[model samples]
Target chain A: MFNRAILIGLAVLLACVVAPAQFRRGGGNAPKEGADAPDFNLKVLKTKKKKIKLSSYEGKKPVALIFGSYT
Target chain B: MQFLLVYIREAHPSDERRGRGRGRGRGPEVKQPKTFEERTEVASECVENLKLSMPAVIDNMKNTAGTAYAGFPDRLFLVDKKGKIAYAGARGPRGFSPEKLEDSIKAVLKNKGVAPRKSTKNKKSQGRGN
Candidate 1:
């Protein structure tokens, strides 16, 4: 009985760490390589511009999207 | 290196705001932005204050850019001129590595036949994102 309990506890602990590691806060459902990158309209803080669509970059130049908070 | 910084919701609320029941957390807290305008403001502040030179884009409510790019807290991606993802850096705070990102950019640019832009000044400072 003790052995079984230990095994079960071990399994539970393993699940906790593995789950969070696999599903990280950043990069949820990341796109696969060679997939058509999805596009969206995000405001440009630098120019205080609007209606800047990601699709516009398509067929023009590769666009890299960086995400993060300052502090 | 060509990069963009997406300013999303804050992880914490300012100290004063929290004291007044305005937000959460303490010690220079920045509450998560509820609107795109608010996000833009935060992004602008970072750029101006930090002297961030890289180009950046703001994520929408859906955070489509963030989700698609797998960016949060901080992350880097290198895309080919054709808009296909080339290299994906590790997660931020700990896994984030500027050197790896720079290498990815150089590799992608070279593969695309774009001559690497030469910088007479210190290139390290420009690529390092805090």
Candidate 2:
């Protein structure tokens, strides 16, 4: 019974570590490769407060969209 | 190439997942932003702290851009000159590698016959999301 409990505890710990990572990456509906980039007219966090649209950059230059936030 | 950092929802707020803080044993204590203004404030702090050179944008309170890109935590997408995704970096944290991103960017530039401009500084930076 003690060994069984230990096994269950380990399993729960493993799930705790692995589950969140999977959920983070498993966010479905992300745009796919070779697809037209999704258009977004998001607010720029600068002094101008000007909104920038993704489509504006089309045919102008390559755009690298890095999605993240501050912790 | 133009770089844009899209600010999304907090990934590890103090209330949830409380990841390690700036120092030992203390988690980066932050609560999820309740309003767009609050979110933007947090994003501004992030940009200032990181000294990000690229322009930063805030996702809507509804998380429209974040939902479209599944951009929680972090991710990288290289859009080609034609507005198509040239390269999609894996979901980040563990999958985020600046070296791999740089390689992919170089590959895309090469395909476009664009010469990479030399830079005096060789600093490597990674974006951290809440």
Report per-candidate TM-score of chain A alone: 0.57, 0.60
lDDT by residue (A1-71, candidate 1, tens digit) is 99999999989987898556666644346554445656667777657465577666655565565667656
What is the C-alpha lDDT profile of model 2 across B1-130, one tens digit per residue?
Answer: 8999999998777655544443224434677898999998899888988899899989999999988887877888888888887666667776666776687688778878232433435212222121
- In model 2, what are the clashing residue pairs, if there are any? A69-B129, B10-B130, B11-B130
Clashes of each: 5, 3
- Give TM-scores for every candidate, taking all chains together and pairing residue i with residue i: 0.67, 0.74
> Which has the greatest lDDT?
2
Worst 10 residues of 2 chain B by lDDT: B121-130
RMSD of each: 8.0, 8.6
- Per-residue lDDT over B28-110 for candidate 1, one digit per residue giving the tens place of the 0 to 100 score: 44556677777777777777877888766777788777766666656766566666665556677565777876776666666
Fraction of true interface contacts that also occur in model 2: 0.79
User: What does the lDDT read for residue A28 in candidate 2?
Assistant: 57
* DockQ class, candidate 1: acceptable
For candidate 2, the TM-score is: 0.74
